[model samples]
Target: MADGKNWRRAGYVGAGAAGLLAGNLALVTGSIVRAAGRTPAAVDDGPDPLLIDPPQLMRSTVAPTGDGTLLHVETSLDLDEHPSDTVLVLVHGWTCSTRFWNPQVNQLAQHWPVIAYDHRGHGLSEMGEKKVSVAMLGQDLEAVLTSTLPAGKRAVLVGHSMGGMAIMSWAAQFGANMADRVAAVVLTSTTARDVVQQQLLTPPTLPRYTEMVKPLVARAFVAAPVPLPSNELTSRLTHYMALGRHARAAHVEFTDELISRGSPRSRAAWGAAMYRLDVAAGLHALSVPTSVVVGSDDLLTPPLHADYMAQVLDHNGVLRDYVTYGGAGHMVPIERSEPYNVLLDDVLKAA
Candidate 1:
């Protein structure tokens, strides 16, 4: 009991410290103290160096949306032996881009062809017209899958955070048709529903405070310079905050990469969708093997959320698997890549 309490307490402390550090850095970097603790070494020292090795094939284009809104899409494909038998399509979470899956892309490419794309408004993808909805994202995925993957062979849908919600919405709307196309499903650091009210590790909604501060967050995100303080600070805070209680320097560094690629608008859009989403009713229709993975230390999408997801699917007579990582948080893919890849590979083989 004491051990569990300590782990949870440490998780919060890690998040708080990281958040405080990033917030301070963003505010202070424009001042003289910029020389205080600023350096690449001060940022990351993990197994692999930071951004030295980018994905093999970095490609992007504006894909046409039926409604005339362009879908900004960035795709990375491995150079060698791209698997045709199985394809994996990765969807990123709110405020994040495909770059977060860098580690997984590097590893998974060895065995299977992997594709990671930015959602419409996030990353290199074109922003949607008025507002981004879960349904819109679902439609985007459907269009991508139709064009990219073969007519007969459907791809595995892997989503993190908001990405997961998009998959859920897709599954709910298309039902058996989507199920036939999906060989497997992976939900990481994501919720079945109620994401806005429950997942964020924030104070109670002060609508007034949100209205007052949103412009600042937006301006801060847009006006920030390259290798900017916001990116650095968030990368650090999210890494520190979400690391497994026993996480090492390498793990933190990997997780940092994911956080750094996150987008402000994507985060906000998905947060709104999470609050309004209700895919719980659709879980029953999914026929593919589903995997739910989360960190034990995750506050935003806790182990309980994964447990609830697994239970709901099981109750509906669906076969699903649930995994919990120690000392990790809302960034399960980066934090637990090896285990995640193994499970994904196993599911692909079975599929």
Candidate 2:
């Protein structure tokens, strides 16, 4: 009885200590990133489209996930001027909302009908009772597709980070019916599996421990559940970790704004999902013409991940292209928007 009590006490103490350490680690890493990473480009005085005048989209409608939870889905279509036959369904990564695709949406909406949705816990979406997992992301995506996609019209799915995972998950789960709706796929700065093992967000030594790092420190980093600080230091850190060398000051601030809005509960929930992510089957299941884009210096999901995914996508003659932007980081979609737009143009043309 005494031993059980002592063990329980120790567990409590250990958890508290871990939480404190994770908090401190975040600050330390942020400082390091600010110090060592490239300086942001000059800020233009003009109002940034993302922050000041974000393009107004269609009504915010609710879409039910596979489990019956509602997800916030919005669309932008300029059918009167530039009518396009195909659709673009954009999904964002962990800790981000539909606004993450604002850049692409603004540019592409002029020609293509664009649909973007928030994950269950991000933005205005309702979190279902089920525990969060990569599989659940795929399920949510399916719900969005079923709800918004017009019957008999196919759409191209574009996902970034966890968004990419959702696409892969969908392909794996519903590959047999994929052709019915999915016209093509675009995976940007994402991985198939073993993200913790392959990621460089934390130091190298942390993951070497067979027992601790993968299961503890790295996961703890994502699952910290602490509110994101919106200070200049935190913005710089976010820029360093998520953006590439070419990122501008506005980019950093924009990214920080979106990240800061992420609720603690949602961050913790999705962090765990991403930490233990494995979607190799989904990668293999993708039957549509697909392109994998990676920033050469991405720390979250590095080029190595893109390499493996490109290889998997190539297996069934489905790989249309593989691109590595030289000075970009994890957010290749924003960091290289023009090039990304061109890539989309190619995909839509081919589709």
Top of the candidates by TM-score: 2
Instruction: Tell me the tens digit of each residue's lDDT in model 2 across 1-351.
Output: 999999999999999988866666655455456444555553546545644434555657889877789999887645223356678889998889988877777777767877889999999998778999988888888888888887667889999998999998888787786778898999999999987667766544332323332345567768888999788777767877788756767777778888999988999988887877888999999888899999998988999999999988798899989999998888887777778988997788778
TM-score for all models, in order of appearance: 0.72, 0.85
Model 1 TM-score (2 dp): 0.72
Error of 2 at 65 (Å): 1.7
Cα RMSD, each candidate: 12.1, 4.5
lDDT for every model? 0.65, 0.80
